[model samples]
Target: MFTGIVEELGEIVSVEPHGEAARLAVRGKVVTSDAKHGDSIAVNGVCLTVVDVEDEVFTVDVMRETLNRSSLKSAQAGARVNLERAVRADQRLGGHIVQGHVDGTAALLSREPGELWDDVRFSLPRELNRYVAEKGSIAVDGISLTVTSVDEDSFGVSLIPTTLELTTLGARRQGDLVNLEVDVIAKYVEKLVVTK
Candidate 1:
């Protein structure tokens, strides 16, 4: 599991296609400091296993399912990605629990710049809308953020100066696609309620 706290802004070194799947080489010094084969890492909100680690770079294989579900399908060399290592049992849960399993991809609908922050709205998928609630936690591109507002077709979040400076959300523009993972708790609650 991850806490949706970004550890570093990594760069993609290369993307090699293998039939429907692909192999990615990413350069992340911090995340690869102690990483080894089989270790899990969150890349832009999608969990991927480490296939190899060398010279501060790690390689991972992306399956077709992940490609179809996330923005990673269009990932290219030189792109920046949020990186996070799986949480250790003794570490604090600074952010909300995040599985790094992106539910879907959403596009930035608008951005309203403020003196100290940016209020951004993103188009919400119809199926995922029910899981989002105002003030609830959500993971966007592996960074934990609280929803400021929610509606039938879109949701909003306020990005503070730190968030704007640290994550990919700061540079995103209207029509840019991002991976989103709704709160796992909400999904569980829905499943239980529906079964009753």
Candidate 2:
């Protein structure tokens, strides 16, 4: 579990493939302060277990399934990633519950800067429309943000300065791909309602 609260913006230091699998190494300060081998870390919205830790860099294996489902398929060295350590038992729930399981990926459609913040619009996959709602929570590229509004094809979110400075979202360009995780509660509710 994670809060979508990004601890620090990390860089993909290296990516090496072996047969059908690959190893991903990420380097960051805040997130590696107490990390150990076998720990779980949310890298760009994907929960990966740590297989190795050296200095501030840690590595995880990327299975074929993970690559196919996320923007990580195109991840490369020097790419900026949002990093979050697994939520602890005694920690406060600053953000909504996030499983770090990406439901899908969204494409950035446009961006509009405002005096105090910026509003970003992302294409909403038709299959995920029912699970997203205005004012509801959504995780984009591992950063938890509220849905400012929703439409037939996409949704929008307002980004504060802090969010802009601390996450990869600040650098998102039009047409960029981002990982998306809808509210888990919403998915469960929809399942029950449709089955009735």
Candidate 3:
């Protein structure tokens, strides 16, 4: 499990494509400080296991399913990614509970700048739209943010100066794809209600 709080802005050092999967070497000093083989790390909101860790860089294998579901399918060697180590059992939940399992990818639709913040809107997938609600928590690129508004096809989030400076969302432009993970609790609730 993860708190959805970004710990570092890491860079993809390399991407080696195999037949049905890809191996990524990411440079993240803090996340790799104590990381070992089999440890889980959130790369851009997608949870991946550590295959190797060396010299502040960690390697992970991305399966075909993950590639098709996330923006990582088009990830390049120099792309920046949000990194977060899995939450320790004793640590505080800084953000909401995030599984690092991205449901789908969305594109930045628009951005409106505020004096000290920016209100950003992103296209919402039809199936995921029902899970998003105003004031609810969502994970975009692994950084937990609250939904400011929700419509049929898109949603908005207000980003403070800290979020703008700390995460990948700050540099994202219109049409850029980002990974999104709706609240897990909401999904579970829907499942139960539907089966009743």
Instruction: Write down the lDDT of every candidate, Cα atoms only.
Output: 0.96, 0.93, 0.97
Residue-level lDDT tens digits of model 1 in 3-51 = 9989999999999999999999999999999999999999999999999
Clashes of each: 0, 0, 0
lDDT, candidate 1, at 115 = 92
Error of 3 at 30 (Å): 0.5
lDDT of 3 by residue, 25-101 (tens): 99999999999999999999999999999999999999999999999999999999999999999999999999989
TM-score of each: 0.99, 0.97, 0.99
Q: Write down the worst ten-residue block by lDDT for model 1.
A: 162-171
Off by over 4 Å in 1: none
Query: Model 1: which residue pairs collide?
Result: none
The TM-score obtained by model 3 is: 0.99
lDDT score for residue 33 of model 2: 90
Show where candidate 2 strays beyond 4 Å.
Answer: none
